[model samples]
Target: MNDIGGSDTIKPAAEAGRVTLPEQGLWKNLGQADGLESAAQAWTPLMFGQLDCAEAVCVFLVDPEGGRLRATSHWPRTRMPAGALIGAAEAAMENNRGVVRGGVGDGGQLTGGLVSVATPLVVDGIVLGAVGAEILPQDQTDLRVEMRRLQWGAAWMRDVLRRDASMADKRRYSNAIEALNSVVNVAEQKDIATATRSATTALATRFDCDRVTIGFQRFFRTRVSAISHSAQFNKQMNLVRLLGAAMDEAIDQRGVVIWPETQSDDPRATHRHQKLAQAQAVGHIMTTPLYSRGHFIGAVTFERPTDQPFSQDEIEILEAVSTVLAPVLDEKRRNDRWLLSKLGESLGGHFIRLAGPGYLGRKALLVCVAALTAFFWFTMGEDRIAADAVVEGAVQRTIAASADGFIAESFARAGDVVSKDAVLVRLDDRELTLERLRLLTELQRGQIEYDRALAARDRAETQVRRSQIDQIEAQINLIDKQIERTELVSPYEGIITSGDLSQSIGAAVARGEALLTVTPIDAYRVTLRVDERRIADVVEGQTGTLVVTSLPDTSFPFAVRKITPVAEYADGATSFRVEAELTDGFDNILPGMEGVGKIDVTEARLIAIWTRPMVDWMRLWAWRWLSLD
Candidate 1:
């Protein structure tokens, strides 16, 4: 028998031969009733109603599995008994797809009416099944129609199967996404590397790889930890270097790299990895970069036992697993640094205590305390001197305009302690009033002339009435302007300290000028300047007892009002301006009385004073240099 499998007689090229064009010679060769069973049902009625033809038919199914072939459907079989197995089915499964003239009945009987053609059923890369149709010799034209119908039926089946396969792949991808989410959500406790290794190992087992590794990239080197399945496996360092080098290309370019069958003959791929692969019997290699927070953190690699390239689905799984490992690795690295620092601290403490001089350290401590005390006394207690400072009422002034025009207006001069809004000047409106009156008189004169020019008509009388109305309006305008400029007020209200205008009249004042300067008459603040070297020992909110020279030995309570950051260059020294407010201003105290102010900057243990200055000087010098402005 002629066959195509395992033989030199049927060449691969001969089996690859393509089908002839169907619209011409083969188009008319297929019978209408000789198509697939479903096609036969559709075309049989058309043939019987239109063409008046009825005939026997045969259809064969060609299966790729086991290269088996079988009779799928037959016409007149129920009445005439099952038809014998035909050689046409075997011929159709082979040689891609072709038409052949063959006899039926187990290779015994003559069945020349059979016109068999095989149509391949393929979806993606998988071959499903093929269809073969046989027809009667008398209905040659009808047989051609049947063959064409079978051709279209084969193509339709291929499309339906392909859609189903694509949908299945999508569902698989969705499941992978969910699995990745679950892995990422797991809590990351201490020992991040072990946690990552545990996760990577579990994933590698699921994907059926020889080994799985997790690593992070730092500069030119990649630090890797190999988490193998068997306990006998030790960490292999050389493998880490090679994997890091190989991954740099993919990571820098943001792409994927696949190396197939690298067990031997590749110098770029590490021999150490090859040995491990040999031990584990792996054949394929896939490395994927791990990305987090829009940066490439590291990579994860898998080793397989077969040379088959990883499918896109498998690569997606690796990427998803890498996402889960990224955070765990970063946490582990941070924890490692913390552990080393603690170890260093423990050792340094012991070394310093065992190797230093004893007496010198104690004497140094005592001197430091004394120096600190002196500094506090000079800076913070600078206002607390032996001489006394008195509590006196603040000085104030009130000014009013000397001349009277219209007394235009006032902006809260009386009882108003304004900082800058005191108004003591105004404008005059008498001249404006005179102008309005003059204009009104002119209007009346014009009215009188018009009235004389016309007596019978009352038009001139209307003009005279209009002029009188204008005179009244002018009077109202004069009153408004006089009222607007009628008042000249005091600048500020401080018990009218300087300007007591209730008893004075016609006090001429300038057009625009300051009337008074009002200071608070109840409370008072004493300001003193302290040397810069002593400023730090002073602080805000410090309290001190105050004595007034005017009151002899009597003392009053006081507090630090403020310590200005600005330094004043005065009296051959740099000093900070300090202000202190007393609890009460003296009832009979006067301004400009000479007094002294003092404060206590510190009260510290004696030992701290001696070293404080040197410590402060070193601190300032170090800060100036190291902080670099």
Candidate 2:
């Protein structure tokens, strides 16, 4: 009997009755009537109950050899005849579907004959076995229903078979993995000759091949360097030469090649390989190419007896093994054993691979890096530094108290647009008016007294009245000026930015005290708070755009007018207060409206523009560590 891994194992047919169904419940159609006899015994009873069949039902499964079908139950021991529904069962298994052959006239409940239904248990497209059932006489009225019920039972059997096949495949896969690990361990050996001999021997042992040869590329041609059975062989030997030629044939094709090729799917060049295998009486042959640094480096060929041709799974495993050993073999060819040398070789190999052809992914990445380097090195872009900024009027003037008086009424407040000389606040003027009237009456009396004194020839009286008249005139002029100042007016046609004397009505204000700040709405300057480190790049006349949060959709262009040497601390950073005037007016720009500004400096390479910060930091770091005298 052949085991799951295609290895021959000895087990008595009677022993199969002892094995049981796997613990993991059944899945798809892997059970050709379920696993060997013991598995069938476990499931046949349940299928019998669910299928509405007669008491006697038989399930026969195909043996692993695929030649004969064995009964799962103790059916051969029973009184059932060989010809009893065996044809129907075989038909179902062959067709891979359920079949109901006996019809109403052929077999009916009235005649005491029950219909027979059979179904195939298939898994992964291979028919494993089939189940035959004799429908209950009463339930056999409709052959279609009986067949459907039998099919459902067969589907369950298929699930059971599928599970068994899956477990077998998994076991086989594990064995393949272990074999690969062994070959890989040999490849890891430092000495090339020893590793090659050991790996070849291991491959022959694991794969049960008659011969295994390792060939390497020399001068663009494959040369047989190692053979599994013997380290020393005559190159002049016809068999050895033939094997070398076969390996080279596979290597030149640049892919996995199998001799006695089964696949009509691929365009095959296995003529030399097949001829050599035939001449040597080697049954099967396969060669897999190895690649290193994105170049074809060598090939490993396996030859076995006629019966054990390479399966797709084995071919796949060998291909993976080739890939795993390529780099190691390349390094071994260099004959370098030092750790640092090996590391450098590995890195160099990677660089070569990146620079090599045929690998689209690595090639694409190299192209991208080169393009980016050129773009950053040769292309020039604007060098701009961002700064926190706010809009302010070009000429912001403060409205001050004109005279010492009490505020009476307010006409406008901050943010109010006012015309030039527009009244902003009214001050009390009744006292000034009364003082003006008294001064006017005193002035008239003083003038009359002066004239009378002069006519009566009194010089001293005339001098006193003349001095009083002059003093009275001065007092009246002062009262007139005080009265005029009662109404505080805007200095210009602009918006009131600061003063809000609405709540301070009737409050006394001293002369020259700032009452309001009015700024022209049309003229605006951006006060930029540039970081001290970047302030040097923000000299006067540098032009850029300003974008405020309020009018974010619009960008106002501006030029640096002045850079304040004095620094201010805001948001935990020290920045110089730089002033920039807008080259173009914005209606939305207002005093104290904050936004961010970018100042353009001389154009520079994109690499320099992006990496300036890192370069500056490195310079600072170098300065910190170096003490150059």
* lDDT digits (tens) for residues 1-629 of candidate 1: 01111121211123323221222322232332233444423322222212112233344444436655554544434422123224444454454564444433465443444444445555565554454444433444554565566566556445544655676689677757746653654244456555556656676777777677666777655566545464333346555556556566546656545665333333243443444445545677777777765678777777776755577667766766566656655666556667777686556545524745559778788688667756654643123322234443344453533434433433443344444334454545566667666767766775676566466577657666665767666675766655454454433333332333333233444544445445554556666566676677667787666655666566556677788899889668788876676765455443444466667656554434545668777667655544311
- Candidate 1: Cα lDDT at 427: 46
In candidate 1, what residue range of length 10 has the lowest lDDT sum?
1-10
Error (Å) of candidate 2 at residue 228 is: 96
Tell me the TM-score of model 2. 0.39
Model 2 lDDT per residue over 495-519, tens place: 9889798899889999899988989
What residue runs in model 2 are displaced by over 4 Å at the alpha carbon? 1-380, 617-629
Give candidate 1's error at residue 33 in angstroms. 26
What TM-score would every model get versus the actual structure? 0.28, 0.39
> What lDDT does each candidate get?
0.53, 0.75
Supply the global lDDT for candidate 1: 0.53
